[model samples]
Target: MPSEPAIASAPHLNIVPASVTPLPDAKPRRALKVCLLGYRSAPYGGGQGIYLKYLSKALVEAGHQVDVISGQPYPHLDPRVNLIKMPGMNLFETGLTSIRPHHLTSLTNIYEWMGKLTGAFSEPYCFGRRVLKYLKKHGRHYDIIHDNQCLSYGMLDIQKQGFPLVTTIHHPITSDLKIALSAAKSWTERLLIRRWHSFLIMQRKVARELHHVVTVSERSRMDIADAFDIQPAGISVVLNGIDTYEFRPLPNVIKNPNRVMAAVSSDQPLKGMRYLLEAVAAVVPKYPDLELLLVGTPKEDGESGKLIRELGLAKHIRAVSGISTEDLVRYYNEASVVVVPSIYEGFGLPAGEAMACGTALISTDGGALPEVVGDAAIQVPIRNSKAIAEVLETLLASPAWRDELAAAGRKRIEELFCWTRAAQQMTDYYWQVIQRENG
Candidate 1:
């Protein structure tokens, strides 16, 4: 890497502000060396993995040599793109009691083990230490490192070492912490929730220190600014793109009249699955055959399970996990409507996916859903089961309205959410960062 520009006053502290100075023009893109970094990017994992998979593929398609450096549950990348594995304790898989003496021999491992034992989710921090080690040895390998929300202490060191770094803060983890705390039933549960998200402290500090931050939605950028105490001006909002080709409608598939699909991860309270279930229960009396197909697992002993039984919706609602990508698309195509009842989303992938599949969508006016869907889908208020029930009933009765929403949703996705377009925009952002830093 070229020698960093000289610093005058407080030189050691490099604080890059979010600026929106437009780049000069569309110059021919230099075939840049790029590294997409993630702490834990599991393929079957929710939106983060999907973002990595498609974004890297699109960047590779645009002729950039993209390398994904990830910790445990590595990302599934295109054959053309490189995967550099950075291993961690993956303590989520290993129980805390199973820690052996040999594991604690390494100081980093010891720190990670202890953090997990104390209920502090330390993967991001531990992974950052590993990333810093890797980059120190191979600093010349990549022109730029684009991080996927692993804002840890090591990331700050890497930036200080003069590597051009850009981090995408999907949304501030503070929002998650706030929502979780609010949902906790007991004092012990709230304490545990706080401990599990302790890494947000590190992330908050790192986010403010770093330069060239990218976010998936304008709403996320704004929310991240408030949550992390970073300037919104310093953060760039790059809307997440949909894989139009892979997620397109299956014309041969017949839509189910009484079925509604929701693609979510764990039955997290933030997902607002409880509201959807209540809505489903309310609808079942009118449309006796009404069924809710959830494409994610509920914690068998968690609130979701208890609620399902309470609502007597065990038979009416089916929760399935580990479906293949093909099956996901097929479900999207066949469902009467896809509902994303998230209380908030940094970027609503479910809405975009359903739109790409030409499925009519009913989503809450959660963070970024309206921005992503853009009047293409029906919008309901947050945490309103009655509103959900009414809109759903209306959509079920009006096939013509559903058809209008489906067509509009598909067209909206096509125009605004193409992977190629996102890559091009990101590619331009990369050049701007490099050129800005060089000068």
Candidate 2:
């Protein structure tokens, strides 16, 4: 095996221009080859995968070539976009004990095994190693690499090698760690949670040293600076966009009067699904026929599942997962109102998607939710089940109010949260970084 690459000195990014302005939308200013890096991506990988898919598609439509290099659970990408597969142990998919002697033939595999054995996640680090190897050979072929929150040492090494690198920190992981700690039932459990999130240490180290960084929202930009100890001035904010065409109001599908909906990712406390469940329980007595459509699966015997059983609301809530995007829009259109009970969010994609689908929303003023929802949706305080129930009753009783909110939400998404606009802004920012680096 080769010796580790030296920790390279941080490169300075020349961002501010003196006296040059382009006439509105002048060709590019320029378009260059872009490589997007992700440790994991969708069908099942969640927001990061969705981000990779849409951003690449949008950038390609803008006339730039985009290549996505990703590890396990590879994303479903646009046909126009190129994909380079980087395989890791993906031990999370194949159980850690499944590693064979053949797997330990390489140092990368060895590192992955050791990390997994010790109860740590090694995907980011392993993927970075593979990506660095690829770039060292093909580094000059691309103009820039846009990383989707894979803040590993290899990214820093690539930057030092004079490759123009830009990273997106969706939100600080510290917020997640803090929230999980508060929910832990014991010291041992808290320690285990900390172990799982220990990757943030590497993330923090890489964040401050990177020359250019982008975040999806103003709130995320501020939070990243504080979490990673970097200057906020160095980060640019680009709002994420919804696919308005896909998530449009289904005029033909009749809405459910006694149904409420939320898209949950896990049983984790951060999503605030527990609070939403509690609120459903609070309102069900008033509307005996009410149903909560949860568009996500809970772990078998997981806390979310356990909570539902304990509350005796198992029959009232339906947990569905693995639905297609086309089907998701249908779920949004049918619900009486969508609820975003999350304690926090980086940009609130679910809320944005729901609003795009013309569903009335009741969202807590969690991080960036207020920014994403604006006055277009109903706002409430976080963790207040009574308030949620009250709003639910009001929305269900008054169809006019629901229609009014639905119209405002649809309009807001069209104006503020469309993918084409987001792609355009991102393209401009990409050019800025490329030109600055070349200069």
Q: What does candidate 2's lDDT look like per residue over 166-244, in tens digits?
A: 9998999899899989989899999889998989899999999999899887778789989999887798877788889
- Work out the TM-score per prediction: 0.93, 0.93
Off by over 4 Å in 1: 1-28
RMSD of 2: 7.5
Task: Go through the candidates in order and give each one's C-alpha lDDT.
Answer: 0.84, 0.84
lDDT of 1 by residue, 3-61 (tens): 11121122222222113333464233569899999988875677888899999999999
Q: Residue 366's C-alpha lDDT in candidate 1?
A: 89
RMSD of each: 7.0, 7.5
